[model samples]
Target chain A: MFDSHGFHQTAMAELAVAAQVSVGQIYRLFKSKEDIIEALVHDDADQWCGEMAEIQMRMDAGELTIVETFEQLLLHTIDEKDEALSFDILAESFRNAAVADTIGTMCQRFRTYIRYFACAANDKLSGEALDAAEEMILACLFGLGHRSLSRPRLSASSAARLTAEMIVTALGGVR
Target chain B: MFDSHGFHQTAMAELAVAAQVSVGQIYRLFKSKEDIIEALVHDDADQWCGEMAEIQMRMDAGELTIVETFEQLLLHTIDEKDEALSFDILAESFRNAAVADTIGTMCQRFRTYIRYFACAANDKLSGEALDAAEEMILACLFGLGHRSLSRPRLSASSAARLTAEMIVTALGGVR
Candidate 1:
């Protein structure tokens, strides 16, 4: 709804009314509409990062096979909430700096977290090798999720096995 | 513009006016808004398939390295037209049978094309192994392209190398 109306058309007063918060309170806490947008983006990113960390921990502890870990990642990334949040942020980011900054911060943090997990998943990976592994994993999964938006999707389990196998073959160290 | 207004808010009359075509002409050619949307989706998918066929030919001829081929694919996929087209069709597909059917057709065609290319790239890969490889290539590239939307992207060339190398490793053959 906000996307349809756009940030520009949707005023802070209207937002406060819609949110059932006093305009004074909205301004007092968020400072401005842009700040409010930034805060929401941050909240969404935090939620995603939190989920990713849990998945990473499971991977680190070897609770799931490489494929299962990938499946989990795909399910989360392609899940409707995450997909909507990503689309919303990307749509807004083109003309908005605060949103972009929030996203950049989130993605940077995500990179750090994923890199750590990639290493933990297989101690054999580190340095540049680890970086590539992280990039490949993230990029591939994002692509798969985006593709699923309009077409038939691979089952999460199937995608996980395929991805896990690919990563193992590529990196040669995942157990 | 359609995305900002959304599929529902964008009227056929408005679209016809924007395209400088009469409503009668629009209806005669496209049948309805959903048909017009399907036509657009088909146009984009056809263009993408054409591009892929060319890449496969070059790869088959040894005129391009796997990395170069991948870089070209990324440039095309992440190109503004493709991304916007994909997003538009996807946004509409959630509720429209015409759009969904159009996407289904495009995906089926794409799958056949990708499968053929995979085998050509590595005659040794077939059946399940080939299937897995095809899935990996497409999915990873999609993910990489999607990530690039919000984050700084790797040079198309670097991404090509990274993706090609991963696919080769996964499939264990590429000539």
Candidate 2:
């Protein structure tokens, strides 16, 4: 419902109908729409963190190369469902402080995962260089999410692979 | 109003009041809110293209290095007003085909500007490598817009410089 109608436009009644639950039931489960959004954000973060953990383990075990793992991370940001809703909430975050805090927390968690990947990709990367690499990669992933709204020539996987290779090269080249 | 209240939530009357015009006058000027949005997008694109043209001219004159020009372009995407409104319309674009087309045109123009920068940054980059460099940089710029919502440790200048350097390195390194 949030994906199609946006957070503000989506009503509790509409969400109830979509979820196959009564409005009262929704109130019982979640205090308000903001609460629901917070829960959803946390749920999404947990899922992404779990996937990152698995990929991190793979990296540790030498099951995936640094570029491959970076590509995998970039690929995770391409889901249509998550992409639209994220833009929706992101706009809402501008008006709502609580939503901003929730989004900040989620972003912080995602950054931690990206930082770990950056470390594994280039041990020579440290301090400001490390932060820059992580932040640039973060921007790429977030920017890729916006690409679905635009027409791009490359397939998502191809785009992800190219982006990963670029970032890894940058990391390797950085002083 | 679209930046604060969103496209759907902002009424025609409210928009008229905000512009200090009567609702009927607004109707005379724009057929619908979507028309206003399309106009706004085109106006914004024109301004950006004008800026890019100026930068391109400077590049041709050898007044600025490739990384400096790239950083200047990246810095253009960081205005808070434009960033918020962009996210708002971007979410609306998911629901409105007309708005989507407007966004697509704007994106195409922006991509052209970035492509020129990519070519200038590395003469060897061509075909898929050139496209990849431009798209990756596009992602970084868009992602940087989103970073204002999150807390980024690096200042916009620092981030832009770091991102530009990284992408230029990748462009040079690409086979």
Error of 2 at B12 (Å): 0.9
State the weakest 10-residue window (summed lDDT) of model 2 chain B.
B78-87
User: Over 4 Å off in model 2, which ranges?
Assistant: none
**Residue B33 CA displacement from its true place in model 1, Å:** 4.0
For candidate 2, the chain B TM-score comes to: 0.93
Query: Model 2 over residues A71-156: C-alpha lDDT tens digits?
Result: 88888876546555777778778888998998898889888988988888788888888888878888888888678666888888
Return the TM-score for each candidate structure: 0.75, 0.96
Candidate with top DockQ is: 2
Alpha-carbon deviation at A104 in model 2, angstroms: 0.4
Chain A TM-score compared with the true chain A, each model in order: 0.78, 0.94
DockQ of candidate 1 compared with the true complex: 0.30
On residues B33-59, what C-alpha lDDT tens digit does candidate 1 reach at each position?
A: 778677777787888899889988888
